[model samples]
Target chain A: MKLKVFLAVFACKLTIKLLRLLGRGGTAIPGKIALRICPDLLFQLAKDVKCVVVTGTNGKTTSSRIIEEIYVKAEASYFANRSGANLINGITSIFIENSTLTGKPKKENAVIECDEAASKEVCRLINPAVVLVTNVFRDQLDRYGEVSGTLENILIGIKNSPRAVVCLNSDCSLTASIAEQIPNRVIFYGVDVPIYKNPVSEVSDAPHCIKCKHEYEYSYRTFGHLGGFCCPDCGYKRPEPQVSVTDILSTELSFTKVRVQVFGEDDVITINLPGGYNIYNAVGALAVSEAVGFRRMLAKDAIASFTCGFGRMEEFDLGGHSARIILVKNPAGANQVLNYLAGLSAETVFVCCLNDNSADGKDVSWVWDANFEKLADMSELIPEIYVSGIRSGDMAVRLKYAGIDEDKLRIFDDYDELIDAMKNQSLPVIIMPTYTAMMDLRAKMSTAFGGKEFWE
Target chain B: MKLSICHLYPDVLNLYGDTGNIICLKKRLEWRGIDTEVTLLPIGANADLSRFDLFFIGGGQDFEQEVLLTDLHGGKDKEILAAVEDEKVFLCICGGYQMMGQYYLTHTGQQCDYIGALKLHTVGSDVRMIGNYMFKCAEESSGSTIVGFENHSGRTYLGEGVSPLGTVLHGFGNNGEDHTEGARFKNVFGAYCHGPMLPKNPEFADLILQTALSRRYPGTVLPPLGDGLEINAHDHMADRMEKQ
Candidate 1:
C-alpha cells in the first residue's frame, strides 16, 4: 500500500510540473492529485525534513519568507512554497514541488507559512518544532468571524504543536491573554520606540486593552494596535516584552537601520526593505529566528540583504511613471502608506482601490477606522486622487470625511478607466489597492505595458 | 440654527468607517442649507450635550465600547439622552449601536452596562455574527443592503414591544436568535448596518437628515430626488423581492 501511494504521489508531481511549465495554476495541481490518490502522502513525504510552521492573521507570508531566506543562507538545504499558498492544499502543493521521484523531499527543513484556520490540518500531517504567531486583528470579518473566534482556531494549532511557539509579545495581552489556558514555549518580539514618529511603519493597532473591559492605555502607538499598552481600568498592562525594537530609522526608499534588543544589549540590524512596516515584520522574523536556534548575528546578516519579498513595500516603474505598490488590505497598512506618502513632497496622486474580496475582508467599513480623514494634510500634498475599486465610492466617502476636499476626489469603478486616468495623468501614482484587486490591476497594467519586470 | 452633531469618540469607534454615516448626514443637511456641524467629543471632556441637535456613534470592539461606555456613563450623557427624548435626532451603528443600549454581555460571560438610551441587551464573546447583512425596514416601502462585513460575537436582544432596526435580508443580523437586526428608538437610530450606512444608500442617508430636519425646522418640505435616489430605490425594491 505504501509503495503504491508513493508511486501515485510521484506521478502526480509530473502533472503539476507540466502544468507549471504551461504557466497555469501549477502549485496546487500535483499536490491535489496526490492527496486525492493518497490522503496520508503529506505525513509520509515530510518524514525526513524538519518542518517549521508560521501562521497568524497577519504577517505570516512575510515572516515565513524571511525565515526561509535565513535557512537559505544556513545552506541546510530547505524547500519553501514562496508564492503565498497558505491553505491546506497550498502547503500540500509545496511538499509536492520539492519532492523526489521516489516521493522523498530534498531539504533539511521544510518551512511552511500555513493559513491561520488551516494550521490544524498541517500540524496533524507534520508536527513542526516552531510556530510564529504575528498578531490578531479584526480582519476579514465576513469569513473569519471575529478575532477572538479566530484566536480559538489558532489555539488549536498551538496545542497541536506544544514544543515551541515564538508568539509576538507586542500583542501579548491579546494572544497571551489566553496563554494561561494553554501550555507552550511563548517568546515575544516588538519595537519599544517612544517620543518620536516612525517615517515608514506607521500602521499599528494601538487601542486594545488587557482585562479592564476598556481601551489599553498606550505609552506609544507603533502601528495598528502593536505597542506598550496598559488597561486604564484595573491596571492590566502590556506584558514586558522579551525582545524590543530598540532603534529604527527609514534610511532610504527601500532600506533602514533598525536596532533590535538581544540578550541584554541593543544590536543594530540593517535591512534593505523600504517602509517602517517591513521593519516591524523583520522584527518578528528575528525574534522567531532566535527562538528556533538561529543566531541573531547570522539572521541579521541574511535579512539585511533582502531587497523585496512577496509584493509589499515593492516599487515598480511602469514607464516614465513609477508606482510603489503596497497591499493596503487594512487600516493599519493604509495608515502606513499615508505616512510614507506624507513625507514625500513630490506631486503624487494616490490611486486607492477597494474590493470586498474575502481575502481583502468583506467589510469595507473598517476604512472609517483608518484615520485617513485626519491625514487631510495629505490631500493638500497630493491634490489629484483616483479612487477606484469595487467599493470606490465607499473609499471616496472615507477620504472626504478624513477632511479630504471632496472636489479633489474622482471616483471610478472601472479598472481600465482608472488605470488610463493614472497613465495619462502626469503626476506619479501611489497604487494602494486591496487583495485580488491589486492582482487584477497588476494584470491589466502589465498586459498593457509589457510585463511585471517593467515595474521592478 | 447651528445644529451640533456630537460624533461619540470619533477617534475610537470610527474603525469601520461608521463615521461615514456622520459625513453622509452632514453633507446632505448642509447641501439643503441646514447648518450642521459634526464635533468629536474628546474622552472625559464635557461638550454641552444640550447644544447638539443630533448624536452619532460608530462601532468598535467590546473593550472600546466599554471605554466609551465608562466615559459616557459617568458624564452628563443623561442630559444627552434627555436631549434626544426631548426631540433631537440620533443615529448609531454597530459598536455605537451596541454602546447606546442598556447593557452588553461579553463572550467571556462578563457584562458591561452601557448608557441607558435604548432598551436593548447585548451578550458578547462566543461565536461572532458575521458575513454580509442586508437591511429591510420592516414597514417601510424602501430597503437597503448593507454591503459590508460583520465581526462581532455579541448577540443583541431588543426589549419587549421595542421595534428592531430592520429585518435581515441576507445574513444572521442579530445573532441566530433574531433575524430582526439593530434597534430603532423614537428619533434615536441604531443598527448593525455598518456599511457606513449612508454612502451605499444615499436616499436612506437623506431620510436620516430629513428626519433630523423636521425636528429642527418643522415647516420646510423635502426637495426632489436627485442623482442615484430613484435608481437605488428601484435596485433596493428588486433586492427585497428577490429575497422574498
Candidate 2:
C-alpha cells in the first residue's frame, strides 16, 4: 500500500513537470493519471490535511479564494486549486502536487474549490473538515443534467462526509434543504436584507419546495432566489443563518460595505468585490471560517483584503481604456453580472462572448433565460453592445430578442478584432464571457495589453 | 387580429431559456403589426385554457416534471388534451413533449403516466442525448429545415395516430435509433429542440403563428420581417451539424 501511494505521487509529480515544460497549464490531467495508478491517491495524500471544500453552482472560486485569504491571514500554511480546476481529477492533482513522494501533505490547511457534480467523490476521498455549499442554480445542463441533479450531487457528498461540518447558504432554499436530509452539523449563511433596490424578475431554479411541491414565497429576495423564503403549505422556510448580512451600508463599483450579524454579534464588513452575490460569498466564507474554528475578526478582515479571482470581476487596462471581465457560466450568474451592470451609471460598452464548448455548456439556450431585457432598459447608458466568441451570432440574436436595437449590436467572432476594437473605445468596457471564452479572450487581452497567466 | 398565447407552467418547466420561445412568439407577432396578449399560467393559476389561441410549454428537470405532473392531475391535463384535440396550436419542448405522450418508462422500468394527448410513448435512458441538431419539417408542414438544441434521455417513439415534426438531418432525434425528431398532431407541435426553438428559426416561428392566426382570421397571412440575424444564427448551427 505504501509503495503504491509513493509510485502514484511520483508519477503525478513527473507528469506536472512534463506538462509545465510543454508550456501547458498542468491542472487536472496529472491528478487523473495519478488516480489511474492508485485510486485512493487523494485519500492518502489528504489524510493529514484539514481541507475546507467549497462546492456549489456559483461562487465556488470566489468563496474558496476568500477562505484562502482567511487561511493566509490566520498565518496558516495552505494550498488550493487556484487554477480553477474544481473537478475530481484537478483536485486530486492539486493534493498530490502539494504532497511528498510518500503521500504526506506539505500544507496543513487546504482551501479546495470543488465542482458540484464532482463534490460527491471529492468529499468522500478528501474527508474534509468543512464542506461549504455556496448555492445551487441551473448550470451546464449538458454536464450536470439539471439543477435538482446538482443539489442531489452535493447532498450525496455531504451525506458521505458525515464528520465534516456542512456550511450552507441558508437563504437558498435549495441549499438550506440539504440540512434536512443530513445529520452533519450545519452552519447557515445569507443576507438578511434585500441587496438591490430594484430586483429584476428572473427564473427561480427552485421555485417549488424540496420537501413539498408547493411554491416558495419570499419575504425578501437579495438576488436570484437567495433570500427569506417560506413555503406556505409545506411549512419549509429559510433557516435562520448563523452568519447574515443585516444591512447594506454602501455598494460602490469597487467595494461594498455591509453590516452582518456573525453568531449574534453585529459587525460591519467590507467585501472587496461588487454585486449582491459577493455579499453572499462574504457571509458564506465567514460561515466556513467559523466552522473551521478561525477567529471572527480575522475572517472579516480577510474578506476585505481578498481580491477578485480570475475572470470573476477581474479588471484589466487596454491602452488607456478600462475593461473588466466577469465570467458568466449560467443564467443565474449572468443575471448577477446584469445586476452589477444595472448600477453602472457611466457610459460603458458591454461585450458578451458566448461559446458552446463543453465547459461552456453546449446548449446556448440558457441565454434566453437571462434577463437581457434589463440591458435594453438601460440602452442609453450602454451605447454599444459587442457579441464575440464562437456563438456570437446566437448572442446577438438573444440581445436582439431582448429588444436591444439591431443598430447597436456588433458581432465580432475574432478575439483580435474584438480587442482591437476595444483599444479605440474611450469608455469603460464590461466583457462578459463563458468559461472557455474567458480563457481564450483573457489570453488575447493579456498578450495585447499587459497581464499574467491565470495559473501563474 | 390579436392572439392570446398561454405560457404553461413557465415557473416549473422553464429549464433552458424557455421564455425565449414566448418572447419570440410575441415579438414576431408584434413585428407584423399583430397584437399579442401573453398570459402566464403557472402551477395553480386558474384561467380558462380555451381562451388562449396558442400555448407554449418548455422543458424541465426530473423533479420539476414530477411537480408539474401533480399540477396536471389537478385538472391542467384535461385542458391540455382538449386544446390538442381542438387543433389549437401548441409548441411543447423536451419534458413538455414527453408529458404529451402516453407514458415515460424509466430506466428502471418504472412507468410514469403522462397526459396521452399525442399517440406516443417515451423510454427514459441513463444517458442523455444532448447537442445541436438539424431537421427538416415533414412534407405535410412547410417542409422547411429547422435547427435547434436537443437535450433529453427519453427516446420518444410516435404511435400510428401522429406524424413527426421533422426528419432528423443530423444528430439524434426522437430516439438515437429512429431518425424521427418530434411528433406533430393537427396543429400540435412537440420536439426536443429548444435552442428555445423559435428565436433562431423564424420560419418555424412564423409557421406556428400562421397556424394559430388562421384559426381566427381565415386566410390570414403574416408579413415577413427581417430575419437576417436569425437565419445567420440558424445556419451557423445547421452548417456545423451537416458537416458532422
CAPRI category for model 1: acceptable
After superposition, which runs of candidate 1 have C-alpha atoms over 4 Å from their true positions? A1-8, A11-15, A26-40, A165-167, A176-183, A194-208, A232-236, A239-242, A405-407, A410-420, A446-456, B8-15, B27-51, B59-84, B95-185, B220-244
Model 1 chain A poorest 10 in a row by lDDT: A195-204
- At residue B113, what lDDT does model 2 achieve? 91
Model 2, residue A71: displacement in angstroms? 1.5
Clashing residue pairs in candidate 2 are none
Every model's TM-score: 0.83, 0.98
Which candidate comes out best when scored by DockQ? 2
Per-candidate TM-score, chain A: 0.88, 0.98
Model 2: per-residue Cα lDDT over A6-114, one tens digit each: 8888998999999889988868889888889899888888889998999999999999899999988999999999989989899989998899888888989899999
Local accuracy of candidate 1 as per-residue lDDT tens digits, A323-359: 7667776666677677777767688878888887777
lDDT of 2 at A346: 97
| Predicted candidate 2 versus true structure: per-residue lDDT over B129-158, tens digit per residue | 888888899877668898988888889999
